[model samples]
Target: MARAHWHFPRTALAEHYLNVFDVGISSHLAFIAPRRKGKTAFILQDLAPAAQQQGYLCVYASLWGDPNAPHESIVQALEQAIDACASESKIKRMLSSKVRKAAISNEMLGRVEVEFANNPKSAGTRDLTRIDDLVTQLEKAAKDRTILLLIDEIQHLATSDDFSGLAHSLRTLLDRRQGRVKSIYTGSSRHYMHLLMSTQSSPFYHFANLHRFPDLGEDFCAFLQNKMASEYGVAVAMGSLVKAFGDLDHSPYWMQRLVERLVTEKCPLREAMNYTLELLDAAEGFEETAKTMKPVDRLVFLELADNGNPFSRALLSRIEAQTSNKGIPGTVQRALARLMEASLVSQIKKGEYHIEKPGLRRYLEKQVGSAPSR
Candidate 1:
């Protein structure tokens, strides 16, 4: 129960972030990474455990878990933590089953997982005093331990103006708590995270010292290699595994799926990787997401993926010829905006972007490559 054997612990990284909190560099820390790159796993498995060991009473939740009302999710975590803290025995487990259920229930970017919740029945709203009151109660409940709130998929708060109130209230509440309540927030998009935490207009502006969640490296691959050898008796070549990890966008979840096939089928690495891509494309529903885009949107998304300037004259000319949209700039702007809203793309600064769903690039390529010449 210390740490999952399969989980390669980043104890130093975890402690480093907490040390920042301890020194008052910032009580709030925000880390952004694309989906399925092990952000959630690191927060729950590595970071939370480390904070608890440091005598912090941690309450963890994912806004994606209860998409309808993100406020409710935070309140629930606080309430759960309070209950758990009241009982010395339950405090150790720390709402493990409940928090993880939230994590697993919504794993994909915006479509299948937390993305499913973006279109809530209504705008995201939080009861200010309720969240404040819960945290206050938790402080009393936790006794000597500092209260730590770990919120995942925090970028959703920046997705709409509707969440502005919740964003404002939570930041204010945490600020008022002063070091009483410390938090670590994990987000899936740097673009949205920028809108959430970096923009001066945002309540969270300068509220949390932000960090890019580092991707799992070769050590992660080595761990997988050992796990496969020791548990599954599958001998996978090291170079092959490393290349596949890069091919899979360095995502641990997909890599693990590739490993699963190796264990059961005892198949060649290439065969397993192909199978994983097929599974990844399907799981991400890239085809279905594409069906929703405009022709220009599809073209622009792929252009960004291929590292072509979307506003280049050639691309604009192509868009005009293909879609017959005369307002080329307007059309392209809307297309990029739609892709961002769809959670298919993310902006780095102004014009630059990182594909939120990289798998979509492959899908678009197949569509283009398979098309009859126009």
Candidate 2:
């Protein structure tokens, strides 16, 4: 059987961002969006392709690809980009070196191959220096063409102390290159992305234009409905498809799963929607995660969910009463730390927090009756 494919048209938005770069509004940009929202897909499939067509050398990297050592991915991507611009003989020599281990695939370097490496340690100063040198080499090799770096999960650089030197080196690279080297940094965590771009102490602070990546809206919904009916011979109602999309917070990643269920299982739309919700809940580990939290932490989480101020005296008093604690400040502080460590909450700024998973709020509200308050 042939593979099914779906192409989402985001070329217009891609062009808009590139145009911002071309006009000198900013040579670097930071795109913010939640997980499973197709940020990576838009970058790899749409933006990179558009930039390449506009005579730019695009090198794509994902920091999350190697959670331990993201710089390795950056190094590999730059090396691949350098090879892409190398002479035919040089490319052949490079290919020859690796051919004995694995077959030489033409498509591997058709665009820069972004792959993760297994290095237990975080990137050191030396590794960052090497990446900086590789960027310089790629820029030189590209001649007059602009080198556009599309970095995904860029928040890791800011959140992880190990990548500080790399972040500085990258900022310096972009600073020196000016118009010649541009970057599009994408991250799923808005809180961490803000840490990268908003904190004055951060290396990338105010370094790039920040934009919230829009969701795959009505167009994507209609496309999925039509594509399933025409290509897969699956009949799914448009309203049900839209509802499924909404139920998953408009995530194309999950919507694709719904489409697969509809086509392969020949399930009814309602059944597929329920299955998708189950998959999402399971993926989030909703109930299991809640069980692990202490009562104080859960209460603090509820307060954040209800948009209540964690630092306010009234909220603190309420938390104190609920948890039977005397030291409200210390108790709340520890709860915040524990919640953040579990990835359930994110500190947007000093005295402010956001529930990392919005769906978790709904789940908790369902599981715990009414919202907790002062």
Most lDDT-accurate candidate:
1
Please give the lDDT score at residue 28 for candidate 1. Answer: 86
What does candidate 2's lDDT look like per residue over 266-332, in tens digits? 8898888788877777776777776777767877888898898777798787777766565378888
Model 2 TM-score (2 dp): 0.81
Provide C-alpha RMSD values for all models, in order. 3.4, 6.4
**Per-residue lDDT of candidate 1, residues 166-275 (tens digit):** 88888888888886888889988777788888899999988888998998999889999998898878998889899999889898878878887888899999999899
Collision count for each candidate, in order: 1, 0
Clashes of 2: 0
Candidate 2 achieves a global lDDT of: 0.76
Candidate 1: 10-residue stretch with minimal lDDT: 117-126
CA lDDT, candidate 1, residue 296: 86
Error of 1 at 298 (Å): 4.3
Q: Give candidate 2's error at residue 47 in angstroms.
A: 0.3
